[model samples]
Target: MTQNLQYFLIPFMDWRIMLLLWGGVFAGIWVGAIPGLSGTMAVSLLISFTFSWEINDALAVMCGTFVGAVYGGAITAILLNIPGAPAAIATGMEGYPLAQKGEAGKAIGLCTTVSLFAGFVGVAALAAAAPIIARFALKFSPRDFFLLAVMGILLIGSIGGGDPIKGIMSGTVGILISMIGMDPSTGELRYTFGSLNLMAGISFVTAMIGLFGVSEALTQFRTSGAKSPKQNLTKVIPDWPTFKKYLPLAVRSSLLGVFIGALPGTGGDVAALLAYDQAKRTTRNPETPFGHGAYEGLVAPETANKGAIGGAFIPMLTLGIPGDAITAIIIGALFIHGLRPGPMLMIETPHLFWMIVSMLIIANVALFVLGLLSVRPFAKIIEIPKSIIMPIIIILSVIGTYAIQNSVVDVFYMTGFGVLGYFMRLYGYATGPMVLGLILGPMLDSNYRRTMQIAEDRLFPFVSGFFTSPLSFFLTASIVFMLFSQTKLYRKWRGIE
Candidate 1:
């Protein structure tokens, strides 16, 4: 125990290591606040630069960047409706409205507070329950993943806010768009339309920049010369009462994030969306209507995504499996550093495991401080005049889109999506469900196909498998309950309205 404590305290004891963690976190915030600059990209860049550095130093910086990047994505989501990362899509749904209402600072403050708590929750779960959670997560089959994606698709109704038919239409359009590239399994061309540029499929980041960033700029053109909302920055941090009110929700969402993040092939993006949907369904009397700046809406996704940071590390450290893209890069870094990550990794290098946990704790603390300091500046961005800000936003969108692949064709596609999203907004169609569909569509298609192959084209056996396995049964039942909750009968029985 003493040796383990010494190992964990090593980073804290060394000022250089601590300074590196803080520096990485600060850099990560700015990088992640910009669209198309992902944590994966930042970590990959660090891998190249930090190759000659000590493994401990490299891990400390990477850990800080991972935590800070996840938290920073919500910054743009709140102020500009442009999620810096896919995980912040749901955050934008609730947060952008708050920004428009001039409550961006308060919303962000609450987000930071909950994020810190959730980060600790995730770290605690990683420290105490990692092995058990990793073992349980490995039990998920492709069918279960498909079911999870289905559950994600069902969230369109919650995020849609109005006109279920229109929301479904938007979501369907996104899913179709997601199918444009070559099929990964069969290597067959999809909706490429004989164009070589289309064969690569549309990157979701480009779509996101266009759909949220560019479309938002275009929408503001209709209200040209209008003054932006004046945000109240006097009391940015939420009071004790406010924090207490949402504690249960933060805990629930964070735990959900941990479980989802621990699953291979899933990450904070899935976890955040799911938690947002759950909060929408379960919270009977939100302070404001969901999609219109509800505090509960902001709390759910923020907490979940932060918690997912810790969750992403669980499988990597315990099972040698990357929980998400960022972790996959971290896995490569581990191999480069001459450390093997597997079931025996903890036994062989217990110090490394504990040191990582220690580093994450420090990172979360840095995130809280930096997150609070950033809220005022981020909120002020919303107060900029539309005439000046809109064009700059469009330019940023273009730059972000082009940066994704350095393809001018992608910029054109982004402009097209921006036009489409603008029309959709004019027609009262919500863009959230569309983005959700794009994110989940591939997961749904690939997993369902794999499950079908395993079933050998037998529908009956495939259907029976849902009930035959305990995990599948639980997931199936949850789906059924979610579907039933959408009905008038269920709402009336529960006195929902």
Candidate 2:
């Protein structure tokens, strides 16, 4: 215990390590606030520069960046309706509306507070229950992943503003768009139409920039000369009573994030969306309707994604499996540092684990301070005249899209999607479901194919497997409940409407 304590305290004892962590967090926030500049890219670049540095120093900086980047993604989502990262897609649902209502400062303040709390929850889970959670995550099969994607798709109804049919149509169109590239399994061309650019498939990041950023710019053009909302910055931080009111929700969403983040192939993006949907369903009364600026809507995704920071570390440290793309990069860093990551990693290098936990704690603290300080400035960005801001937003969207794969074709694709999104919005179709579909479509298709292959294409056995496994059974039940909750009968029984 004394040795463990010493290991954990070592990073704090070194001022250089502390400085590196703080700097990393600060840099991460700005980088992640810009679309296409992902945590993965930042960390990967760090590996090249930090290879000669001590492993502890490299890990400290990277971990801090990871936590800060996830939090930063919500910044743009709130102010601009353009998520800086996929994880913040759900945040934009309510956050953008709040910004329009001149409550951007208050909304961000609450997001910062809940994010700090959730970060600690994730770190706590990583410290105390990592092994248990890691073992449980291993129980998931391909079928379960498919079902999870299905559950994500079902969120179309929740995010879809008014018309469920239009939402479904939007989502289905997104899925079809997602299928434009070559099939990974069969190596067959999909909707590519023999175009080399189409063979690479449309990157989700490109679509996101087009659908959210560019689309938002075009939408604003419809109503010319509209002044931006004046944010209320007097009381940026959430009062104690406000925090207490949403404490249960923060806790619920954070725990959900941890579990989802621990699952391989899932990350903050999936967790945030799922938590947002769950909160929407469960919270009977909000100050405003969802999609029109609900506080609960903001709280759910913010907490979940922050909590996922800790959850992402669980599998990497314990099982040598990357929980998400960022973790996968971290795993490679571990190998480069002469550390083998696997079941025996903890036994052989327990100090590394404790040190990481300490680093994350420090990072979260930095995030809280920096986040609060930046809220006013970030909110001010929303107050800029739409005439000036819209063009800049379109330029940023094009830059972000081109940055994805350095392809000009992606910029064109993004512009096209932006126009499509503007028209869809005009026609009462929500763009959120389309992005959700694009994100989850590949996961669903790949996992379903794998599951069927495992079942030898036998329909009966494949269906029965869902009920036979305890994990699958639980997921099946949750899916059933999710579907049932969408019905008028269930909503009336529960007095929701």
Candidate 3:
């Protein structure tokens, strides 16, 4: 125990490691706040630069940047109605409305505060129960993942902006669009329309950028003459009472993040979307309605995505498996450093695991401090003139779209999506469900096929498999409960509606 403690304290005593952590967080916040630049990209770039550095230094920077980038995603979501990252999609639901109401500071402050709490929860889980959680993550079958995608689809109602039919329509279209590329399991062309340009399929990131960012610019053009919201920046940090009020929700969403993050392929985006839906379902009599300016809406997703930071590390450290895209890059980094990251990782180098946990702890603190300091500046972005800001947004969208794969065709596609999203907004179809559909559609498709193949295309076996496996059974039950909860009968029983 003492030796473990010593390993944990090593980073704290090394001033260079501490500086690297802070610097990484600082750089990460800005990079992540920009649409299209991901922590994955940032860390991947860092690999070449950090390959010659000591392992501890590389990890410190990567850990800080990872935590900061996740937190930075919310800044654009709240202030600009554009999700800097996919994980912030749910955040844009409530956050932009709050910003429109001139409460950007409070929204970001609350986000930062809850995020720190969630970061701690995830770190605690990593430190105390890494192996157990990692093993549990491994138990999830393709069917179970498919169930998760189903749960994600059910969220259309929650994010539908009070229109179920429109939500379903939009989500259905998004799913169809998601299928336009080659099928995942097979080499067969799908909806590619005999165009080589469509062979690679549309990236959800491009869709998200167009649907939210460029479309937002077009939407604001109608009101270009309207003055920007005058933000109140005094309360940049939540008071104790305010923080306590959100404590229960923060805890719930954070745990959700940790678990989902531990899942091999699923990451913060999935966790945040699920947490937002859970919050929408559970919270009654909110200060404001959901998809508007509900504080609960801000709290749920921010905490969840932050918790995912720690959760992503859990599997990486314990099993040598990448938890998410960024972790996947880090795994490659570990390999370059002559470190084998798997079952034997701990047995051979126990200090590495302990050091990582501690590094995350320090990085979370850095996120809290840096996040609060940036609230005033970030909130100020909302006050920029629409005429100037909208054009800049369009420029940025084009740049970001091109950055994805250096494809000019994607830029055109993004422009088309922007126009489509504008029409969607005009017709009262909320854009959220469509993005959700885009995000979950592939997961559902790939997993269901895998499960079917495992069952040898037999109906009875496929049906029975869900019940036979403990995890599948739980997921099936949860899906049933979700369906029931959406019924009027359940609402009446709960006396919520």
Candidate 4:
């Protein structure tokens, strides 16, 4: 224990490492606040040059980037209705509304507070229950993952506009669009239509940029001359009472994030959405409506995504299995650093494990301090006139779209999507459901097909597995319960909004 303590304190003793962490975090915030730049993309880029650096120094920057990027996404989601990443989609639902009401600072203040709490919760879970959680994550099969996607599909109603039918329509279209590329198991194309550009499939980040960022810019043109909200920047940190009020919800959401993040192939995006939906289902007589400016809406997703960062590391550090894309890349970094990351990693090199944990804690602290200090300026973004800001958003959207793969076609796709989103909004269709669909659609397609292949295409056997496998049964039951929860009878009984 004493030696472990020493290892944990090593990062703190190195000023150069600390500086790298702080710089990486500060940079990550801006990167994640932009529409197309993502934490995964940023960290992947770091892997190339960091190959020759000391392992601890490389990891310090990566760890800080991971923490800051997740937190940074909420900044733009609140101020501009453009979520920096899919995880912040739910944040925009309430946050943009709050921003419009000139409460951007307060919303962000609460978000930063809960995010810090959630980050610690995830770190605590990593330190205490990583092996257990990793073991649990191993129980998930493709069948269970398919069922999980089905559960995500039910979130259509929760994120939908006032009209559930329109939301369903939007989500359905998104799912269809997700099927455009080659089949997961087979080399055959389903909807490519002989186009080279369509072969790689549409990137969800590009879609999200167009649907949320560019579409928002186009819509703002209708009221271009109207003055933007004069944001109130005072009170950038939530008071103790305010934090206490959200304590239970934050704990619940953060734990949920940790578990979801621990799941292989899942990330903060999925965790945040599920947390948002759960919060919507459970909160009673909320101070504001779920789709409006509800503080719970902000708290749940922000906390969950932050918690997911630690949760993601749990598996990567202990089990050699990456929880998400970023960690998968980190695994490659581990290999480059001449470290074997697996079941015996901690036993072989205990200092690495302890140092990573310590680094994350420091990163989270940096995130909170830096986030609070920047709230005023970030909030001021909402005060910019639409005519000036809208064009800039579109330009950034285009630049971000192109940067993803350096493809000119992606720029066209983003512009097309932006136009589609604008029309959808004009017709009372919320873009949220569609974005959810895009995120979950591929998961549903690939997992369902994998389960089918595993069952040898035998329908009866495939159906039986859901009933026979304990994990599948649980996920199936959850899906059933989710469907049932949408009914008026359940809502009336539970008194959920």
lDDT of model 2 at position 21:
95
Scored by Cα lDDT, where does model 2 land? 0.92
lDDT of 4 at 434: 88
Q: Regarding lDDT, does 1 or 4 come out ahead?
A: 4
Per-residue lDDT tens digits for candidate 1, residues 1-497, read 99999998998998988998998898888878887788888898899989899999999899888988898889999998889899999999889898888899998999999999999999999999999999999999999999999999999998887899999999988899999989999999999989999888888888888888888889989998788999989899999999999999999999999999999989999999999999988887687888788999999999999888889899999999999999999999999999899999999999999999999999999989999998888888888888887898888788778888889999998899899999999999988888888999999999999998999989998899899989999999999999998898977787666
For each candidate, what TM-score against the reference?
0.98, 0.98, 0.98, 0.98
lDDT, candidate 4, 101-160, per-residue tens: 999999999998898899999999998898999999988999999998888889898899
RMSD of 3: 1.0
- Every candidate's lDDT: 0.91, 0.92, 0.91, 0.91
Deviating ranges (above 4 Å) for candidate 1: none
Assess the local accuracy of residue 301 in candidate 4 as a C-alpha lDDT between 0 and 100: 96
Clashes of each: 0, 0, 1, 0
lDDT of 3 by residue, 1-497 (tens): 99999999999999999999999998888878878877888898899899999999998999888888898889999999999899999998999999999999999999988988999999999999999999999999899999889988998888888579999999998998898888877889999989998888998889989999988899989988999999988877889999999999999999999999999999999999889988888886788988779999999999999988889988898899989999999999899999999999988999999999989989989999999999998888889889888899889888888988999999999999899999999989988888888888999899999999999998999999989999999999998998888898987787667
Q: Once model 1 is optimally superposed onto the true structure by TM-score, how far is the C-alpha of residue 153 displaced, in angstroms? A: 0.3
lDDT of 3: 0.91
Against the true structure, candidate 4 reaches a TM-score of 0.98
List candidate 3 segments past 4 Å from native.
none
